[model samples]
Target: MIASVTNAATLESAFNAFNEQSALLESSYRELQQQVASLTARLDEAQSARHRELLAKERLSEQLANTLEALPGAVVVLDCHGVISECNAEAARLLNQPLLDRPWSEVAKREFAPVDNADGELQLHDGRVLSLQRRRLGRDLGEILLLTDVSETRRMTEMLARQQRLSAIGEMTARLAHQIRTPLASALLYASQMSPGDCSDASPGGKVVARLRELDRMVADMLQFASGSNQDDEGIDVALLLADVAETGSLPMEAASRVAVNIADSNLRIAGNRGALKGALLNLLDNALIASGDEGRVDLGAWRDADRICLTVSDNGCGIPENELGRVFEPFFTTRPQGTGLGLAVVRSVVDAHQGEVVLESGSQGTTVSLCLPAAAIPSAQRAPERGFCHA
Candidate 1:
């Protein structure tokens, strides 16, 4: 009986150990199940995040495509062989032709024949101007071309430049007029001292004095222009105007016996400053007198010709050299050492302001200058009263 009990005790110990191991195995299996469930949840979250990221990428790509399509500037993609791969609507419109799958060389030849650089300006046959630029996509992808229409912009820039030049010229003219007016007025004042009195209808001597007074008035008018105030916006009597100019601008009575004035005495009125017209005519007469040597005859005529008032001055004196004729109207150009070189330039400026034209003809025998004024372009101001006292 003692042996049987020892054996039963050993068996009992083995059974207990076996029961403990079974419980441990059950606990381990439960922990493993929990771990697997946690791993599965994490995997699902990762997959959902990846799906959301994919949708965001797709939206971004769509937006980029839409933005590129709506762009106004031309956009073109070129392949490694310089062939166009794709282009936007703007590219076709700007080039005025289809641009897809075309070689860049062919496109350039058709559109920009003289093009030598990738980034440059293209002047189309139809007068459109374009600024072209390029971008390298990558070592393998080739290039991207961008073109912008610059035709209107370039035209505006040129117009602005012309306006700037005109403004500069006006400023210079004002300054020059001011500098010359003082001496001219002083000289006229002294000349008037000789012919002291005025006549109603103007005496032979009185008319000469009247004409001198006109010179004084012209100085005032020029001063007004220099001071930036518009002067002489009135119609002038062409006949009386010519009479005063011819009388005062001629040589002294004794020395001018050989000089003949051939201008018509019509009372036809035209738009202009009386004093300014007198000044211009006086300049022409003085030049004529100089060109005609002592006792040489000069002819002056004025008439209407085909929508214009034409004035002519001819002198039978040494003619200007043919090559030098073109430069006569340029400022500070003269063959005479004593000449100011500004007479013809001033005349040109005045004629240009009136929208008129000038023509000069010369040969070995004589020179003829023609001044043509448009019949219209009158000032908006009312007609000025008869040329009486030319003061404020």
Candidate 2:
């Protein structure tokens, strides 16, 4: 009976051990399932974050492309090898050539011509000016080029410079006029007071007085030009004005016979500053006489053309060089050795003040300068009393 009880006790111990092992395996399996679920959720979150990052990067790339295309100035991208790889529409239009895949050096040579004395600028075949700038992308990437059309900008700069120079000249001319007027008047007074015999029209004293008067008139012209206007407008009879100009003997005594005056109608009239107009005409006459020389012919003619009164000075001497005609009215520009370079400039100023137009035509044949002024009504009287003639 004791042996049977011992065997039962051993069987019960084996059954308890087997039941404990099964419970431990079930707990381990449940923990493994929870860990797998957690891992799967983390993987999904990572994939979603990666997708969002990719979309943001794509949007940024698109914005950069749009900005590049919207630029006004030309933009060109060159490969590391100095070949034009890409460009905007403006680049193509400005360069006006097929630019893709072309060597930069070749394009520069083919489409661009270097401007004289200008660096970093080039002129195209069509005369448009472009300013160029180049920047390296990196040591290994390539370079970017920026080109801007500066034609209008350059023109405006040149115009402003010219105007500034003219302003300076006007100031200097005013000072010069002041300095010259006092002595010139004193000399003229002295010459006028000479003895009666020496003061005859043919005498040397008379000639000296005439020359002094001419000098005084020239000073007045300088002042008028510097002041920018005559400031006095009146009815001027063309015939009487021409008669006075002829009587003034502006032409040298030797070349007096070379001048011929033609008046279409003695009744034609113009409203302007009498002294200013006289000076302008005499100045033109002197230029014509000089151009014609001692033997050549000069014609001072006036006529009515439509609503305008046309006054012309023509010469048979060696004509103005075609290239110089354009610059004749520019201040301080002249071809003569002793020229003050103010004659035509003064004429232009006077005409502008009077609201007139001046045109010059020249060639191997000869030169003709025509001044077109608006025709004015004839005064009720024969002449409007005004300041005396400039050269009288």
What TM-score, over all chains together, does every model reach? 0.43, 0.68
Count of clashing residue pairs in every prediction: 0, 0
How accurate locally is residue 31 in candidate 1, as Cα lDDT from 0 to 100? 93
* Predicted structure 1: lDDT: 0.69
Please, what are the lDDT tens digits per residue for candidate 2 over residues 1-392? 99999999999888888878878888888888888888888988999998999999999988987888888789999999999999998998887688999999998888887658446688887888888899999998999999989999998998898778778877887777767888888888888888566555477778888788778766776677777766366888877777677656453566567777777567778888877777788888888877887788877778889989988888887888877888899877888886767778889998988899998988776788888888888757764443332221
Clashing pairs in 2: none
- Report the lDDT tens digits of candidate 1 across residue range 135-177: 9999988999998888888889976885576466567667676
Clash count (model 2, backbone only) = 0
Model 1 Cα shift for residue 386 (angstroms): 21
Model 2 earns a TM-score of: 0.68
Worst 10 residues of 2 by lDDT: 383-392
Quantify all predictions' global Cα lDDT against the true fold. 0.69, 0.80
Q: Runs in model 1 with CA error above 4 Å?
A: 1-232, 263-267, 376-392
All predictions: root-mean-square deviation over Cα? 13.7, 7.4
